[model samples]
Target chain A: MSHTTLQKKKLIARVSRLKGQMEAVERALEAERPCGEILQLLASVRGALTGLTGEVLDDHLREHVLNAEDDAARAEAVEEISEVLRTYIR
Target chain B: MSHTTLQKKKLIARVSRLKGQMEAVERALEAERPCGEILQLLASVRGALTGLTGEVLDDHLREHVLNAEDDAARAEAVEEISEVLRTYIR
Candidate 1:
């Protein structure tokens, strides 16, 4: 449902990269790294996660919300999603 | 940079939930739960992660890409994002 069989490898690769980022975060924590450095690493991981999530959400919009026939509606969907992100990401 | 100070608490809450979901996945793995159940739990975790990622991505788009001054450019951003998602989410 999320992706076709052919897409699975690339998708898994992305998740694997995310896992690597998470592991980096864990390593930083384990090493008792400085607060600033740890925070920076955490931010990096967060950004990576955000990127991954955005990819999936965009797919969901195309698959579940967007319409090729309606340009105005498509813009509205973007706006709606943007508004929700403003709330949720915060 | 990612979120204003006022948004930090809620943003942290969302990350906390993600942590909880991840812990559940770990527990399931530790318990050697049935393969099917474990896969389901993984799927649930994946979905949660996707949801989290989507939120932050939306914020980034608004902060880094979208424009109130230009509707056409805004829609183009959406379409471009959609295309990338189609490739990435696969």
Candidate 2:
């Protein structure tokens, strides 16, 4: 498969897995699992989310930010990314 | 500043801002903010975290994964990333 196809597959797989993990967390809460285990699961899920985000972002930067044809596109990409950053920082 | 220096600065700034945002979320809980607002904040924070992760991962892929010296290093990099993915999926 092409790199893009491979990337999409990886991303989809990762996200689906994460969704399951998150569902498990919800089930654990409903089942009154130990707070410690729930917290650990939360942390792990966060990490996984981070990892998936990193991979997608990496591809975006490489294919768009770095290789865009003009400065406007680059600036637009940066601004788009900044919007994302702002969301987390608010 | 050199690109590396700029990258480090950006990463630090982004992460520090994220930390502050998280603290705000905690404070909001203590202050008994509406659940809707808290959920909004949580979603925003998740977006920001994704953006930050993307930036760092992009840089890593460009500077390390793509530029690695040999096949072994490349394989190692993939495995390293797989470990991260596993954490999220589990």
Candidate 3:
């Protein structure tokens, strides 16, 4: 099985929680919650997303980069990860 | 109106898109898509979430900090924002 498939259940759970968090933020906005409270909620969601990203990135490195079959394949995987990271952090 | 309320529709639209992007990521994982493709989807979600965070943070600065009623209130708002940012980037 692929690295992501190995951890699929756990990853999906995290994504579910993130969806809930975003919904909460939406409701808070609908109710006109204070900026401070909303900011706190947003920060929590941001932190959670970052955690999920790190997990998936780790899996990608293991499955695609580290375990790649050849030097050229490894280099290609590295480039793919770099592109994703660039978009992520840009 | 509060800063967030002023932009509530726009903000909620962004959050809805983020939720869709996340759902796409979840679906990709469920289908056991290749790690590289999954990583790209995840990165897009991360980037979208980051953009949403920036919009809300900017609003918070204007509403809670810049327009604070007094020096002490402004200081408190600054601290609150600082705490959120620490968690966000940690």
DockQ for each candidate?
0.04, 0.02, 0.73
Model 1 complex DockQ against the native? 0.04
Residue A28 CA displacement from its true place in model 2, Å:
0.6
Where does the lowest 10-residue lDDT sum fall in candidate 1 chain B? B1-10
Q: How many backbone clashes does candidate 3 have?
A: 0
Across B1-90, the per-residue lDDT of candidate 3 in tens digits comes to 778889889888888898898899889879988777888887888778777788778777887788888899789889888988788665
Per-candidate TM-scores read 0.41, 0.47, 0.89
| Candidate ordering by TM-score (highest first) | 3, 2, 1
**Deviation from truth (RMSD, Å), model 3:** 2.0
CAPRI-style docking class of model 2 based on DockQ: incorrect
Candidate 2 lDDT by residue in tens digits, A1-90: 222344544544554566566566556545555333444555566777666555545654665577766898777666655555565455
Cα lDDT of model 1 by residue, A1-90, tens digit = 322122445544655665566566455445544323434444555556556556555654664355433676566556645654554454
TM-score for chain A of every candidate model? 0.64, 0.80, 0.85
Show model 1 residue runs off by greater than 4 Å.
Answer: A1-90, B1-6, B67-90
Ranked candidates (lDDT, high to low): 3, 2, 1
Worst 10 residues of 2 chain B by lDDT: B1-10
At residue A86, give the lDDT of candidate 1. Answer: 58
Of models 2 and 3, which has the larger TM-score? 3
